[model samples]
Target: MSTAHNAFPSQSATGAERGALRGALRGARAYWEMQKRCAIIAGSVNVLMLVVFHIAGLDALALFSVGSIAAYALAWLCLQRRHNRLAIGLMCAETVTHAGFGFLLAGPESGSHYYLLLFFPALFLGSSPRRAMLPAAAVLAAYVALDAWVYAFGPMALISPFDQALMRHFNSAIIIGMLSYLAIYYRKRVVSSERQLRAWAGSDPLTGLANRRHMDATIRALDADRRGGELAVLMADIDHFKSINDRFGHEGGDMVLRRVAEVIQGCVRDTDHVARWGGEEFLIILSATPLHQAAETAERIRRAVERIAFDELSCEGAPLRVTLTLGVAERAGQEALQATIRKADEYLYAGKHGGRNRVCRHADDPGRRALRQG
Candidate 1:
């Protein structure tokens, strides 16, 4: 690989981060997986509550913890079966029921109402905001009703101040832990989404090379910062591409395009910018390189392409062969980048009209010279 600095940002990540991002990319299914994880966490919290309440001789609350754990297990099973809607509905039911129990029996100091807030963002995970609205409003209504009931009648059962405070802190920690996990999950999703958007915006879908728009941007950036070094551009076109498409069909044509892109990419240094400049044309930009070196690179690409045997894309009894016609141009002092590109295009056509599988570097390039002599 040529060790040239790339104009685009790298999308590399650690294995764990990549896994998280990949999970995020799965949309609703990923959300369901996240919901299952939430269920497991909440169940674990209920187990702890079950132990604490049982030890404290709070039989009602301890019995309620057992029921909550069972509900969470059911929700987890629903998620496992891919019944996301049912699973989320079950979770919502458990949240409201548990919150009501805590407020009515254990009192407001227990902080169980915070559990109601967990599903607000979670509601949007498996659904659109509009679809999630009613459920979210129901959660809000439940919270409001619980608050009003507590204001009027107060706690139905009284516990020691010490036990109340301990429960309050325990509930707070659980909710806080859940919220922190959600924040991290959402952040990973956003990062993964941005990376995908960037790739779709900048790359060609068929060839996986930089598209014309990206190449234009790279050219402008390079021109603005010439760094007192030479810049070379090569415009290449597959010889008789339309004929190939006619013979082999679009799928075969696509395979050829992808293969040619790979070969061209391999011929250039890592820092060099290569783009699919629409249809069968490709553009390359070499930084800190002079005309001769660029011409040599173009010749190398031409030879490489010419030797490509399409073993899998045979015509009759023989394998298919492909070739490239390339034009090389170096950016002149203070010359507009577009002008250099046009010069390259002109030379590319010169190579095309002269014969086919050759590289043209100048007005007096061998292909053009041969044509003139002819």
Candidate 2:
């Protein structure tokens, strides 16, 4: 591996942090699955309870109304653990159910007021913050209205048992809001850690470019139609790069390489990608640009590197400069990824043989006019 200094931010975490993140990512998947199965079971139980309560009739409505919350809670718990897009079904159904339940125990003394406490956890388990807050707030607003219209004040104030329960219900909503905030923060951390691990798996330690393994994956992604742009590839090698290590030491050579990689990345578009292709060679992919355009782009990178002065780069020694030779090609006619790569490789070698530090598009083609440009 080259000892180049990369500009990419380092994401190495403490041992405990790394282990915790991996465990969380893996565990979350299983938890979601478990929650989903449990939800189905809970839904079944709730259906049974609702049926029994409905059959009994009369004031049974007040007693059985809480069952709606219970049933919906199960569904929310199940969805919170997975990628189910319809998780909001839980919120929608639950909210409407709560509103119906609210209107049912209309007495100034109805218990429907306290039932609102359940909304907090429901909100916590709800599919999204907005979904959670809306229902909870609506229920709170309903209570505010009920508080003014309840009968405990006897025809003057219509306060009922349900309306009286509003304070406790609102408290529960606050708790759910707190818990949801914490959960969201935890999720953000989990996602950030996973992103770091992904970067480590695919990036070069020295240059921050995609490692060869990642390049392979990128090629697959390109062919799978994952990327929308036309595919162009480049293979580049440093000109007489080894001599720097021979003259100043490997550390100095490393500094030079890091600088070159930066220059290359800077010259490329955000849509384009570059990877360390092992040793002193690099691979680049330019998106949305065709072959002839790719050649021009590659040359632009070449010229950018040609301008970097490495002699000032120092580590217990004078600085150094680096130059590169690049081979350019496109997937215009080739259907297979390997064929496209081979074509670029052929040109890469051609650039090497034609003279170091010049960009070459193809064999028999007039290449860079600069005198070895390095």
Q: TM-score of predicted model 1?
A: 0.83
Candidate with best lDDT: 1
Q: Which candidate has the top score in TM-score?
A: 1
The global C-alpha lDDT for each of the candidates, from Candidate 1 onward, is 0.82, 0.63
Give all candidate RMSDs, comma-separated.
6.8, 14.4
Off by over 4 Å in 2: 1-171, 226-230, 313-319, 365-374
TM-score attained by model 2: 0.52
Q: For model 2, what is the C-alpha lDDT against the true structure? A: 0.63
lDDT of 1 by residue, 206-242 (tens): 7789987788898889878868488899999988887
lDDT of 1: 0.82
